[model samples]
Target: MLELDLTARLGNFALEAKFSCETTGIVALFGRSGAGKTSVVNMLAGLTRPHRGRIAVNGTVLFDSARGIDLPPERRRLGYVFQEGRLFPHMSVRRNLSYGYTRIPAAERSIGFEHVTDLLGLADLLGRRPGDLSGGEKQRVALGRALLANPRLLLMDEPLAALDQPRKEEVLPFIERLRDTLALPIVYVSHSMAEIVRLADTLVLLSEGRVEAVGTIEDLTSRLDLRPLTGRYEAGAVIRAEVVGQDEAFGLTELRFAGGGLWVPRVEAPIGTELRIRVRARDVALARERPRGVSILNMVPCRVEDIGAEAGPQVDLRLNAGGAALWARITRRSLAKLQIVPGARVYALIKAVAIDRTSLGRGAGRFLAGPAEGNLEE
Candidate 1:
């Protein structure tokens, strides 16, 4: 487990956060710019000292101000991947990765050069210098360099923040592999909701130098306070589903969620692929019955679980579709006119255009293939 209870003052900003997690996968620090994410990371890396409190990772104490015990950044055994690749412009990618490995005593190195290369898909680019590599390639090299150090924990501060959409996409799968394949824990910092939903297994929400909330992505996303942070365009619940099959003639892929099967835009994934999908709240429409003439391809029978207060002009409705949870943001008048209430059986209508194609992943496909069981309450 990773734990932190620290306070620090920087110019006009003050950070006082206390949270702990047993996350073995990626733990994301999410918030807007100037939300103390960088500061917290710096403290964890021992680059900055907190005025008070303790920091520990798996029973090893990194800092304890009361006892005046603090380890230096290099001694913290953390692998940090910064926004910039920070690769040696004159050195080949191979050399950069080897440089860190060489610093450690040969007997102490847990990860070997070949293992790093294969894990990062860097075999083809080893001979290339940073100048000759694309942004994604350079970042991979940077990640490889960190991995060779055999860090107990990995700290990535918006490593994809500087990249274009394509570059970000290129690096994401590698990051996912890092989480799934390795035992090392990760503290990833990002303001993007899409990244959090796609990558994080646990979340620590920070705002203006303070922690707002910390929990699983589903738990935090369902909270009203966090809705505004996600922005209306991206506000939604992430669902894990399975790929049952493909409809070749219609150019569509069929996904099975809690209540029923959903046909979405064609996705280039194999059968039995597991995927993650984000269904935006605004894209969901509630129906009292199965409509006959609607063009929507995805409609699942669900019951209203609860309703959140009207924020701005819309009210957020939490619905339980079989065992999976789905959220919809509708006008207050609509909720009243439709007489929507808890336990009311309804159909969740989702347009194909509203589903984010990029957020779809293999993990979701596997979930859809399995029989729906247990409640996935948000």
Candidate 2:
């Protein structure tokens, strides 16, 4: 487990972040700029000291003002991947990775050079210098170097921020592989909702210099109270789905969840691959009855769980589809006309195209085929 209840002062800004989460997968520190995302990670890294409170990971106390225990950065044995790849200019890719691996004693080393290079897909780039590598390649090398250190925790400070869209995509799959293959805990820092949705298992929302909420990405993203920070335009529900089958004829892949099956654009993964997807609230519309003879592919029955406070022209909605939560953003006029309220049963109309490929993500681990459900529309 990772825990922190620290207070620090930096000039005019005062931060009092207090939250604890599991170390199973990626725990993202998410917020806008100047929201202390970096500050919280810095303190955990021992680069910045907290004035009061304690910090611990997996029961090991990293810092404690009361006990006067503050471990140095190196002594903490944590791996950190910075925003920019800080590779040695003169060193080749092989040596750059070895620089950290060689420092750790053979007995303490949990990961080997060969394992890291292969896992990161850096075997072919071993002879290239830092200057010759692309943005994604450089970052992959950085990840390898850090892993060789055998860190108890991995801290990534927007590792993909410097790369463009294509470059980011190039490196995202490798990171997913790393998370699934390794057992190490990670604290990822980023302001991008897309990145967070694609990776994080738990989320720590920071606002200004404080933590607004801490929970699973699925729970927090569906919350109406956190819409202002989650971005009204991007606000929606996240669902865990399994690839049931592919319709090569229509260039679509069907995914089955607890609620029902949703057909999305063709996904290359084979049957049974579990993927997480976001359905934007704006893309969802409410209907009194299931409409037919229409182009919309998904029309699932749902019960209204809650409604949000009116905001000018639009208001957010919380829906329960089977056991899963689905959110929708509808205009106030529609709410008045439709008479949608808590416990009201309605149909949630979702367009197949609204769930884009960019938001699709594979859950960490081996992809297993799920039990065959009867109908694709069910």
C-alpha RMSD for every candidate: 6.0, 5.4
Model 2's alpha-carbon lDDT is: 0.87
Candidate 1 per-residue C-alpha lDDT over 1-378 given as tens digits, one digit per residue, 9 for 90 to 100:
999998999778889988999858889999889889989998999998999989999888999998888999888888888889799888988899987788888887888898778777788898888999888988999999999998889999999998999998788877876666678899999988888777777889888788888898777876666776656567787777777888899888888876678788877667777677778798899899899988998889899998887556678888888877788988888898999988899999999767765566435322332222212222
Candidate 2: which stretches are off by over 4 Å?
Answer: 268-273, 364-378
Name the Cα RMSD for model 1.
6.0
Candidate 1 deviant stretches above 4 angstroms: 248-251, 265-275, 336-343, 361-378
Scored by TM-score, the top model is 2
lDDT: which candidate is best?
Answer: 2
Poorest 10 consecutive residues by lDDT, candidate 1: 369-378
TM-score of each: 0.87, 0.91
